[model samples]
Target: MNEALHVVCPHCDAVNRIPSARQGAGPKCGQCHRALFAGEPLELTTANFRRHLERNDIPFLVDFWAPWCGPCKMMAPQFRQAAGDLEPTVRLAKVNTEAEPGLGQQFGIRSIPTLALFRGGREVARQAGAMGAADIVRWTRGQV
Candidate 1:
C-alpha cells in the first residue's frame, strides 16, 4: 500500500492525502485546489489560531511578529526558509502581535519575533530573538 501524508489545503482548509514521495516535488491542495505553501506564510488570526493549534497533529512553530519591527522584518525570509526546510516534519504558523494583542498577552510575549513551539496543544518551548535559517533549524531539532 502507498503511504499517504496529510496536508491541509491552503485554499479551503480541507485535509488532503498525498503520496509521501511527493514531499519534495510539492503538491497542490485537494479542496479549493491551490499550492499548499505557495510561497506564503500560513495565515493566523485570533479567530482561528487556537483551532489550528489544537487540531494540528504536527508540531507547529509559530512566530509572534509585528510589521514595524526591523528585526522581525529581517527574520521573515529566514522563517519561510526554515518552514520550507522543515515542511511535513514541522508546520509553521504566524501571528502578528500588533494584530493579536490578546494572544501575545496570553503567551506573555515580551519581544517581537518570538518563536514558540507547540505540540499536542501545549507549548513545548519558546525563544525570543532573530535567527538565521540554519540556527532556527538547529533550535527546532532540540525541541522534539
Candidate 2:
C-alpha cells in the first residue's frame, strides 16, 4: 500500500491526505479544490505558518524576506523559480518580515533572504543570503 502524506493546502490551508505515489500526479485540495502544488511559493503569515510547518509531510523551506531590502527583492524571482523547481516534494514559502515581524523575531531571522529548511516541524538547516534558483534547489535538496 502506498503511504499517505499530509499536505497542507497553499490556497485554503486545508489538510489533504495524499498517497505518496500520487503526489506528483497533480493533487488538489480536498476542501478548496485548488491545485496543491501550483509551482509558486506560498505567502505565509502568522495565521497559517504553524499549520504549514508542522502539518506538511514534506520538508518546508521558508524565505524570510522584506520588501524594502534590495537583496530580498532580487532573490524573490529566484525563490519563485525555486518554488517551481522544488514543489510536490519540498514546500516553498515566504514570510515578509515587514508584515510579520513576530515570525521573524521568533525564528531569529536577523537577515533578509534567509532560507530556513524545516523537517518534522523543526528547523534542520539555515542559510543567510541571496542565492540563485539552482543554488536554492541544490541547497534545499542537500539539506533534506
Candidate 3:
C-alpha cells in the first residue's frame, strides 16, 4: 500500500525510515538516534511539505497562516507551545500562506490562520481563526 514512511528528524533534520506497522509504537531517527516523531509543529516549506504529507503516517494538524496577519502573529507562539506539548502523538506543522501562495490557493485558504488535519494526504477536518493552546489541543484530540 506504499505505507512506509521516511520521517525527518526535527532535532538534526535527518531522514529515517518508519515501517507503517510501527506508527503507533513510536519511531526514532537512525542518525541522531532521537525520536523521529518530534510530536510538535514542524516547519514545512514549499519544497518539503508535499513530501512530508505523503510520507508520514501520523495524523497532522497544519496551520495555514501568514506573517503579516495580526491574528496569525498572535497565534504563533500559542501554536508553538501547543506543538511542544503534543509532540510525538499528533504531528503539528505550519504552512506560511504568504510564503507559499500556490499552496494557499490550492487549499482555498481565505483566512490568515487556517488549520487542517490530514492523514494519508487527505484532509479530514479544518478550522480557521486564532486559537489558544488548550483549544488547539482539544480540537486535535480526536483528529489523530
Candidate 4:
C-alpha cells in the first residue's frame, strides 16, 4: 500500500492528504480545489507559517529574506526557480523578515537569505547564504 502524505495547500492553506504515488499527478486541494503545487514558492506569513511548518509530511524549505537586503533581492529569482525544480516532492516557501519580524526572531534568522529545510516539524538543515537554483536543489536533495 502506498503511504499518505499531508500536504498543505498553497492557495487556501488547507491540509490535504495525498497518496505518495499520486503526488506527482497534479493533485488539487480538497477544500479550495486549486492546484497544490503551482510551480512557485508560497509566500509564508506569521498567520500560516507554523501550520505549514508543522503539518506538511514532505520536506519544507523556507527562504528567510528581507526586502531591502541586496543579497535577498538577488536570490529571490534563484529561489523562485528552485521552487519550480523542487515542488510536489518538496514544499518551497519564502518568508519576508521585514513583514514578519516575529517569525524571524522565533527562528533566530540572523542573515537576510537563510535557507532552512524542515522535515517532520523540525529543521533538518540550514544554509546561511544566497545560492543559485542548481545549488539550492542539490543542497536540499542532499539534506533529505
Candidate 5:
C-alpha cells in the first residue's frame, strides 16, 4: 500500500491526505478545490499558524517578517522564488510580525527576515538575516 501524507491546504486551511508518490503531481484541496501548492509562500496569520505547523507532514519554512523592515521587503522576492523551488516538499510561509506580534513573540523572533523551519509541529532550525533564493534553498536542503 502507498503511504499517505497529511497536507494542509494553503487556500482553505483544510488538511487532506495525499499519496506520498504524488506529492509533486499538483494535488488540489478537497475542501476549497484550490491547488495545494501554489508556488508561492502562504501568508500565515495568528488564526491559522498552529494548524499549518501541526498538520503538514513536510517541513514548514516560515519567514518571520514585518512590513516596515527593509530587509524583510528585500527578501520577499527571494523567499517567493525559494517557495517555488521548495514546494510540495517544503512548505514556505510568511508571518508578518507587525500583524501577528503574539506569534513573533511566541517564536522569539527579535529580528526581521528571520527564517524558521518547523517539522512535526516544532522548530528544527532557524536563521536570522536576508539571503538569496539559492542560499535559502541550499540552507533548507542541508537542514531538512
Candidate 6:
C-alpha cells in the first residue's frame, strides 16, 4: 500500500494529494495543474505561510530573512541551490521578515537569515547565520 502525501502547490496555493511512491514521478497539482516541486524556494508571505506549513506532508526549510540584510542577500543563492539539492524530499521557502514582521516576531526570529525546519506543522530545528549550499544540505539532512 502506498501512502498519499499532501503537497501544497507552489504556483496556486492549492493542496494536492500525491502518492509517496510517485513523488519522484513529478506530480502535478490537482487544482492548477502546475508541478508540485519547482526546484527553488517558494516566496512565502503571511497569507500563504500557514497553509503551506499545515498542508505539506514534507518538511519545510524556511529562510527567515530581510531585504536590507547583507548576510541574507549573500545566502540567497546558496539557499536556492540547496532547494534543488534537497527536494522533492523537503520543501524550501523564504519569508521576508521586513514584509512579514508578525511571522518573524511569532517565530522569535531576532536575527536575519535564520534557517528553520518545520515538520508536521511545527518547527523541529533552527539555525542562525549564513551557510553555504553544502552546509545547508548537510544540516537539514541531519535534522530531518
| lDDT tens digits by residue: candidate 2, 1-144 | 899999999999999999999999999999999999999999999999999999999999999999999999999999999999999999999999999999999999998889999999999999999999999999999988
CA lDDT of each prediction against the hidden true structure: 0.81, 0.96, 0.80, 0.95, 0.96, 0.96
Per-residue lDDT of candidate 3, residues 1-144 (tens digit): 747766666666566777776755667778988777654677888788887777665677899998889999999999988887776656788998888898899889998799898888899899999999989988888566
lDDT, residue 5, model 5:
96
lDDT of predicted model 3: 0.80
Model 4 whole-model lDDT (C-alpha atoms): 0.95
Q: lDDT tens digits, residues 57-142, model 6?
A: 99999999999999999999999999999999999999999999999999999998999999999999999999999999999999
TM per model? 0.82, 0.99, 0.81, 0.98, 0.98, 0.99
* Each model's backbone clash number: 0, 0, 3, 0, 0, 0
lDDT tens digits, residue span 1-144, model 5: 889999999999999999999999999999999999999999999999999999999999999999999989999999999999999899999999999999999999988889999999999999999999999999999999
Model 4 spans > 4 angstroms off:
none
lDDT (C-alpha) at residue 51 in model 3? 73
| lDDT tens digits, residue span 1-144, model 1 | 667666665556776777777755667777776776554458688887876677655677899999999999999999998887787667788899898899999999999899999987899999999999898888997897
RMSD of each: 2.5, 0.6, 3.5, 0.6, 0.6, 0.5
Model 5 poorest 10 in a row by lDDT: 105-114
Candidate 2 regions exceeding 4 Å error are none
Q: Which portions of model 1 miss their true places by more than 4 Å?
A: 1-7, 15-28, 37-40
Q: Which stretches of candidate 3 lie over 4 Å from their true place?
A: 1-6, 11-15, 18-27, 31-35
Model 4 poorest ten-residue lDDT run: 103-112
Model 1 clash pairs?
none
User: Number of clashes in model 4?
Assistant: 0
